[model samples]
Target chain A: MNATLVFARKEALEIVRTWRIWVLPAIILFFAITAPVLARFTPEIVGAVAGDQLGGISLPPGTYLDAYGQWIKNLSQITLFALIIIYGGIISTETSSGTAILVLTKPMSRGAFVAVKAIIHSVFLAVLTVIGTLATWGLTAAVFGHAPADPVWSSALIWLLLGVFYIALMTFFSVLIPSAVGAAGAGMGAFVLLTIGALWKPLSDHSPAGLAGQAAALAAGKPVPDLLWPVLVSLATAAVLVAAASLLFRQKEL
Target chain B: MSAAIRAAGLTKSYGRKLVLDSLDLDVEEGSIFGFLGPNGAGKTTTLRLTTGLARPTKGSIQVLGHDARAAGNAVRSAIGYLPDVPAFYEWMTAPEFLSFAGGLFGMSGSALHDRTSMLLDLAGLTDVQTKIGGYSRGMKQRLGIAQALINAPRLLLLDEPTSALDPMGRKGVLDMIASLRGRTTVFFSTHILSDVERVCDTVAILDRGRMVAQAPIDELKARYGKEKVVVEVTENADELAKEFGERPWATAIARGALGSIEITVTDLGAAQHDIPAIVAARDSGLARLEAGEIGLEEVFVELVGGGR
Candidate 1:
């Protein structure tokens, strides 16, 4: 437990000092602030761009639901891409660059090393998600007027869980691969396949992507989608990936 | 003394190629043991196995009386290693990195702080201001030593710690290692003979994944060392060389200009008594006579080169 905590601190410090601290939160907050503003002003912006053509189309008022929808969309697309970039080869880089040699030689267990990396990464993601979601709530409420709070918060947490699942898979792939580029290749390939699985309606409700897909519906005050199973599955998958990473790390040469 | 590290029939292979063959070794407690081998001699591989970084393809290794294969944190806790390159987290300061290392070993509070300070002072890194990224190769090597000692391990494994340093840096690091004599059992691998000659009490020379020779420094010197009796006189150098070569005690003899001759003898004492008499009888006006002793370089070259 002590080894895990110590390594966790180092990993967290690396993220902070390497500028991931500033860049990741800044990007998430950018999405949070813009999603609501764009939702409230779509009509005016569209009208300005289309000129007389907008007069013929029916314009609807933007609601908190629309803000929530935009928020989930940005989180799923841009924020997730940024997350992949930040985490693509986190473990593999250490092995390839020979940095892990120093630490792994210590009295600490290899299992603790892998666990600490995943734990600290999730902690950083949690910090960003909480801050970004709160900003989204405050701005969306102010712009679109007070709305039901339950759905908005539920959506953010579910989307964040989906991102966490992706990071776990990336971590597992990093252990299997010997280099950073190889890890990213395996992680992104699997990520794209999971996204494709969600495109099929029959599987969409149970796929890894369902955690992100059902967010907007849940945020719109609709009866909650059947997400309990998918959320459970995502959490389980992340745990299994972490376990496998630990096992493989123990036998790894470096 | 009990062996700090012991290996028997240890072997390792990378894919289809064997890197370390079946070998046996013993490193005594509290000895500055040098592992000498040329490049591709499996010195690094042997060190890795001893440190539990890699497993052998065959046989076993024991460190501090524990089977390294079954050894988990227990065996690792007893050993500290400095890799040949000694990679570091570039963003961390020396003190910060040491704190992180000590923390991994479960050290905290004043204990960790004091140990880190002592290591920094020992490595002469107390005044270094830059983060690890800005440090030169030599500084990083010093920090490597500091981290290796942070745990105060019973068996310290250093893989070419001074192989990459400049002359002054090498001397500094070597001096630091020499200072640790009798404190911890230091097992370092290097092809540099001067380093082994400087600090090591015992040495094991390896070639082609096999140990060619293992013994105390002085024993190896006395065993393979050529005890040459050089005699100088005013005349009859060639005739004296012939006479010296024919002597049963003389294994080989070389005749130089003037009356000088160098004879590798079977018995230094017997030849010492006979050579003087021979020179005096020849009336060659004997001027100088001295015996030569071997150093680690010759022992290493003879063993390594002959093994090939």
Candidate 2:
């Protein structure tokens, strides 16, 4: 346990000192603040651009829900890609550069090293998710007033859980693939496959990918629909993936 | 005395290629044992197996009396390993890297801080507070040595620590290893014979995954070295060589261009007695006679084959 904590702290420090700490968070924060504001006024901007094309095309009632919806859409597409770009090299860099040999030769076990990396990345991802979500919430409320669409606390919890699950999954992929490009490709491929599975009526309730989709719906005053099974399954799947990563890492020659 | 590291018939293979073939090694406590080998001779593989970084295919290894295969964690904690190319988190400064290494050994708070500072000074990086990425190859190698000693390990495994260093860097590392003579048992692998002679008291030469010879440095030199006599002659060098060769006491004789004859004899005393009579009989005038002990390099070449 002591060695695990030591490795965890070192991993955290490495992430904090990396250039990504400045660039990744800055880009995410900019999107978080500007995404909702853009959503709130995109119709007007579009109408202005359509001047003389339609003479005038006034948009319908644009509620805070619309702004939240835009926020989720932007995050689901761009923010997730940014996350991959930042975290893709987390394990591959160490392995390729031979740095893992030095660390593994220390008193720490391979299992502890893998576990600590997962925990540190998960915590960083959760914190960034909170920052992004809260910034969007503040901006949306300022532009279109707070609405009683859905329970804010539960909705925020869902987003946080989804972020943790994705981070864990990405970390697991990083361990399974030997190269950074391969790991990133595998992670994105898995994400696409899960997204497709979520569209199927029979599989949607059990697919972890539905967690993010359901949270977006909840923010738009739509029925959350029973997602307990998906939540449980997602948590179980994340655990299994992380355990597999640990086992694979343990056998790696370093 | 307990052996710091012991391996019996250690074997490892990658696919069908046998990297380490049934190798055995024993490093006693507080001895600087040099593992010398040519490239692709399995020196690094042997170090990896003994340090618990890689499992052997068909042999058992024990470090500090802990089973390396079964109790790897325990054995690893007692060993400090420096890879051929020591790598670090590029963003971390020397102090931070050492502290992190100490923490992995379960040191905390003030203890970690003290060890970190001490190691930083020991590694001669006390004034350089820059990140490791900016360090030169020599600095990285020095830091590697410091990190390996962070846990006060019972056994230190260094894989070609000076292989990539400049002259000054190699000298610095040699001095540092010499300074740790009695403090820790060091098992370093290198192809540099001079470095081994400089700091190592005991050495084992490996060739093609097999140990050709292993012993104390002086003992090996004394056992394998041959004594030779060089006699400078003023007259009849060819005739003197023929007469010396004809003698039963002279094992071998060679005539030099400068009217000199070199002779190898099993009994130096008998040859010394017979040489004067042969010189008188052959009417050869001797100018200078010299006899000296053979050097370690000659012994090494004779034992391991000089081509490498």
For candidate 2, lDDT tens digit of each residue in B121-233?
Answer: 87789999799999998899999988998998878899999987889878988998898899889999998899999999999988888888889998987787666677777
DockQ (C-alpha) of model 2? 0.60
Candidate with top DockQ is: 1
Error of 1 at B231 (Å): 9.1
TM-scores for all candidates: the values are 0.90, 0.88
Residue pairs in clash, model 2: none
Q: DockQ (Cα-based) per candidate?
A: 0.62, 0.60
The candidate scoring highest on TM-score is 1
Q: State which docking tier applies to candidate 1.
A: medium
Model 2, A49-133: lDDT tens per residue? Answer: 8877866657775777777776666666677776666666667788889898898887777777777787788788678767877
Least well predicted 10-residue stretch by lDDT in candidate 1 chain B: B251-260
